[model samples]
Target: MMDEAVLEALDAYVECLFAPQDEALEFTLSASRRAGLPDIQVSPAEGRLLQLLALMVGAGRILEIGTLGGYSAIHLARALPDVGTMVSLEASAHHAEVARANIEHAGLSEKVEVRTGDARKLLARMIQDGEEPFDVVFIDADKRGYPEYLELSLTLSHPGTLILADNTFRGGAVVQPADETSRVLHEFNLSLARDPRLDSILIPVVRERVDGLSIARVKNI
Candidate 1:
């Protein structure tokens, strides 16, 4: 309901107070830019929210469906315990390589691995291999694949596992759902709400525009 500029300023204010970037995060952003990656990484406030959520869930194993220059990965990995680990899937080999370098620069290589491939294939393979369930799964990949990703992620999660999806609002388009992507996202939100295995809510996140992040906790296997 607020002006866009005001919303951005509020985000900045929150970031300045609670998510101030240190050297590693700054380096990650700069290196990501140098590599010509899209500037679609989570905002600092949202990154901090991810970190806090990981900490709240005491996540030991984290799975990320998208790794864009490792910006959000750094935040999530920072929440891990010394022995905790994360596996992030990136569709672009170049993005994965950039993410690896950024993560290494952040001294988080030991805690994080960036795998390059189609996220759906990678997730399906992990499921077929009977991989250990993850404590948290962050979904931030292609919009159209969101529903499939959610289903696959559930296969990789256990009771109490936390699931997060970004850009659910599609800049407020989900309300009217004018396009295919928005309609899909709208239905995704509806499914999240009705799915018996999970309890979920969509929280608005502001940047250049209003978007949303859907947070769900698996209540039953």
Candidate 2:
């Protein structure tokens, strides 16, 4: 278990680095509080990274696998061009509804759409319908299904596409693999490391209990 002092120290550092919030960001933060959702929201560093990635990749088309009250999507879409598009999938209608309300309040409804359903099903359907290959894809969904989500998402990416997976650390149990979530994450991490298609890196984020940011670039299709 992580020591309380370490957790407190990390929290202090994160608070110190907390970025400035605009109307949209404030609303997303409020929605998260109102929903009492877990701390799955993006960190300040990751938020900055998302914007950088979007602009760098010219992310005209984006796909997000976990809406989580639209925190990450808002960060990403804020970086997107006026003509850019972002489609987010949330299994919980409650969360999706909150996200839509916040997106609309932020005047981004036209550029971002929050769909409610199983992410796997929704992604498969989008593929069948000929949606253009996503330029940026973020996966922060159910822990046990991380591998499946990663595999499915890879099929829709090109060399320029960026795939970011959250919570790959699973509170440091990933290195041990004693629990199911850790075991799955461990397998996923190993697979990601070996995959020839992607050049990747893992960043430790969060409190004394760390999480990960796995940034992978797909090779040419």
Candidate 3:
């Protein structure tokens, strides 16, 4: 297995080759840092992967459970066609403000909406309001919230919708699952695999450490 340094170098090599950051993306990271946001946003390579997945699915509408400084949101929104739109849920009002500013700076304000509130409550409200199904749902929030997020995301997805969750491997913790978060993530992966309405797989992603992105396509319902 590659050491952390090698893994990071490999990630940088991939990002340099295929996901070079633009001015907007650069500004997003800088602003996010200035605002003291956690540096837990997806890496550049993973952001590219998200964009590619969104494009591959021909996503017209996307839903994101986390909007950390709008870094990933910019990537996902860029994959949208002119009329395509996205709604991103952020639990922290401060983070939402930062994300909105970053998105605006990225010239994606018209395409993405960053809503601030409890994700579960917002999702429940969306369901109650009969929100239109999205073509893609990306969850990258609190690990403990993943199970409920997945269930809520399904309510907002249609057949063929793509659901992506980040940090699934949890630095290999899910392998042994000594902690509650790790155990929960392990079970989440299992549920994704066994769910009759979907077909899924966990794609390993490398940064400073090995994590995973869980991708599932809604087969029915």
TM-score of each: 0.99, 0.90, 0.99
Q: Could you give candidate 1's per-residue lDDT for residues 150-174 as a string of tens digits?
A: 9999999999999999999999999
Candidate 3 — what's its lDDT?
A: 0.96
Give the C-alpha lDDT of model 2: 0.83
After superposition on all CA atoms, what RMSD does each candidate show versus the true structure? 0.7, 2.1, 0.6
Tens-digit lDDT track of model 2 for 1-221: 67868976875676566655677777788877888767667766567677778889888989899998888888888878899999999999888888888888888899999999998898888878877889999888898888888888887777779998888888788988898888999998888888888888888775546678888888865
Per-residue lDDT for 74-178 in model 3, tens only?
A: 999999999999999999999999999999999999999999999999999999999999999999999999999999999999999999999999999999999
* Per-structure clash totals for the candidates: 0, 0, 0
The list of candidate 3 runs beyond 4 A from truth reads none
Assess candidate 3 and give its TM-score to the true structure.
0.99
Better of 1 and 2 by lDDT: 1
Model with the higher TM-score, candidate 1 or 2: 1
